[model samples]
Target: MKYNNFRKAVSSLTSQRSDSSLPVVALLTGLAVGAVIGVLFAPERGADIRTKISDKAKDLSDAAKDKLQAVKNKFHSEGHELADLKDEVVDKVKSKARAAEELKDEVIEDAKSKAKDLADDVKAAANEVKNS
Candidate 1:
């Protein structure tokens, strides 16, 4: 049987070497050679096979291109959305900054008013003490 012959061949070759990989490599090489021989001996015309392979390869390439374009479009749309979000965030920060500046001015004015009132009260107290 072919299996028995294959096993015998592998055993014979492995007897010559200690490495386990020798048998595996020989098996793979035998399979590759057999496949090449089979494909060469097949009844189909070589030209027809080549044409079919070319057409299928082209179809696969076009499909891949379409997928790539779709991804590009999605990324572009997401980039625009991100830009809009960035602008929104910047506007909000500017508004907050303006509000903080206005609050600072108001606090400074209030502190000045309070200081003037305290000074006036101190002057009035000193005048009263002098009169007494």
Candidate 2:
């Protein structure tokens, strides 16, 4: 019945032009029109429907607000934890950097001491050769 009529309608629209999308457009239009008709013919009074719609909207709004608040709270708590973690990481990095700097200074001093010793040995060798 209704399906048959819908099929017939589509066939009729398609028969007018095989290369066109008139049938699809007409089908969508028909669905929209049907929805409007159905809503208009609903058994509930207009005022009652309005109230129901408003109540549903309010409920959804409240749920959304609650969810938003929960997210905000979680974000705030996480932010504090992140700050603490950042401080700890910064402290560790600073400690490591200080250690690295100290090691660099020690290596430089050791190299200078070795070079001076080598120079002194060379001078002593030259003096011995001159005496001989």
Candidate 3:
């Protein structure tokens, strides 16, 4: 039961789409709103304040773009890593299955040989009793 659940969890993790960037975007938006509000309330000349606000907005835009790009890069890297992990898992399972098959064959052959030996022993005893 636990193993089935574990397999389900692993498969779900691999299949589910990660929306991890949503939180990052939301945090950046909150920061932008706070910064704008702080800038608006500051006592300063209107023109200078406007310039500062514009610069800050531009800076925030650039930062957001950089972060989004970084997130995309990391997502792609992790996808590759997952693919490699899946391949490794498949290879390991195949190897284990092959090993099990070989073991089964060995056990079957050993049982057959033992059965033959037992049969020969029985036949010899029967012949000895008949002769006596």
Candidate 4:
């Protein structure tokens, strides 16, 4: 149950994060593109340009890691909420199933009682006819 809830929470978070992150992602992409263009056009030595590119790459990587960790923590917290919801649903289903089973048993017993009474009435009528 815990595992299922956690999975569902993670899936839900993934979808939501993707939707909300679109603008951030686009902004980061634009910044990276612009940085690269500026670097290429600058009249710097080849070695200096390479060093700047490496530094930019490391910065982007670190930022991505931070965002990922934050998302992971948020989903982990929400997993408990999902698990509670799942438990409530399972309990309601079990209660309904028990009620249905009880109703079925009552119906069967009532039918049996009625059938026995009917048989007794028929036998009494036949005995009267025999005596007459």
Candidate 5:
């Protein structure tokens, strides 16, 4: 019976050969299985198993915290990149708008000068006619 149980356990562990679980899940499962086996085989009191479980829980908590921090760092970096791109786009738009305004002013000035020249020509012709 013991041999059969051992074989069954080995086969189960082997069948799950693929990396199906995340790191945290895998770690938790491993700790649970180990604690159960240690309790079953231990000659001492249940206090030992309890202590081991507590230690394993602490380790899992630390691991989860590290993973969360890594994710946060990645998001922060991406956010900064997005902000920089927005600034660049705004600056380019402002530059284009300033250029357009200058062009409009130059066109208006040219039109005014041409109209003035035309009026001066008309005045000169009228004066000549009067003198004649």
Candidate 6:
């Protein structure tokens, strides 16, 4: 039950993280489109316009690279967090399994002890009947 809840929570967080990145993608797309349109309509000499457009393209490219790096770093961080959570959950499960095994062993031993006691009582009763 606890594990299921943890899984659900992690899934929710992961989904939210993915959803948040969509807006960044859309913003980048819009910026690129706007740059292209602005470059096409500028009233400068052809060579000058080309140079300006090229510079603008380089700037946009750098901005994109920076944003991409940021996203990558965030993804890496989240991945590590997920791995740590996985390890924690695994440890919790292992401990729970170990506890369950110990309880099972105790229960089996208790049952065996009870059975032995019952057998001894029956034997004592049988001896009493024989000696009567």
TM-scores of the candidates are 0.67, 0.59, 0.63, 0.51, 0.52, 0.66
- The C-alpha RMSD in Å for every predicted model, in order, reads 7.6, 7.3, 17.5, 16.8, 6.7, 17.5
lDDT tens digits, residue span 25-116, model 4: 55765686688778779899979988987999999999999999999999998998899999999999999999999999999999999999
Residue-level lDDT of model 1, residues 70-110, one tens digit each, is: 99999999999999999999999999999999999999999
lDDT of 1 at 52: 80
- Give the lowest summed-lDDT range of ten residues in model 3: 9-18
Q: Rank the candidates by lDDT, best first.
A: 2, 1, 6, 4, 3, 5
Backbone steric clashes in candidate 6, count: 0
Pairs that clash in candidate 1: none
* TM-score of model 6 vs. true structure: 0.66
Clashing pairs in 5: none
Indicate whether candidate 5 or candidate 6 has the larger lDDT.
6
lDDT of 2: 0.90
Give the Å shift of residue 2 in candidate 5.
Answer: 34
lDDT score, candidate 1, position 100: 100
lDDT of 6 by residue, 1-132 (tens): 966885686566556767777576566656876877787887887799888868999999999999999999999999999999999999999999999999999999999999999999999999999999
Each prediction's whole-model lDDT (CA): 0.89, 0.90, 0.85, 0.86, 0.85, 0.87
**Candidate 1, poorest ten consecutive residues by summed lDDT:** 9-18
User: Cα deviation in Å at residue 35, candidate 1?
Assistant: 8.8
Better of 3 and 4 by TM-score: 3
Question: What is the overall TM-score of model 4 with all chains considered together?
Answer: 0.51
- How many steric clashes between backbone atoms does each model show? 0, 0, 0, 0, 0, 0
| Of candidates 4 and 3, the better by lDDT | 4
Give residue 42's lDDT in candidate 6 (0 to 100).
76
Write the residue-wise lDDT of candidate 3 on 1-132 in tens digits.
966885676556545635775565556656876877777897887899889879999999999999999999999999999999999999999999999999999999999999999999999999999999
lDDT of 2 by residue, 31-129 (tens): 977877876998999899789879999999999999999999999999999999999999999999999999999999999999999999999999999
> What does the lDDT read for residue 77 in candidate 4?
81
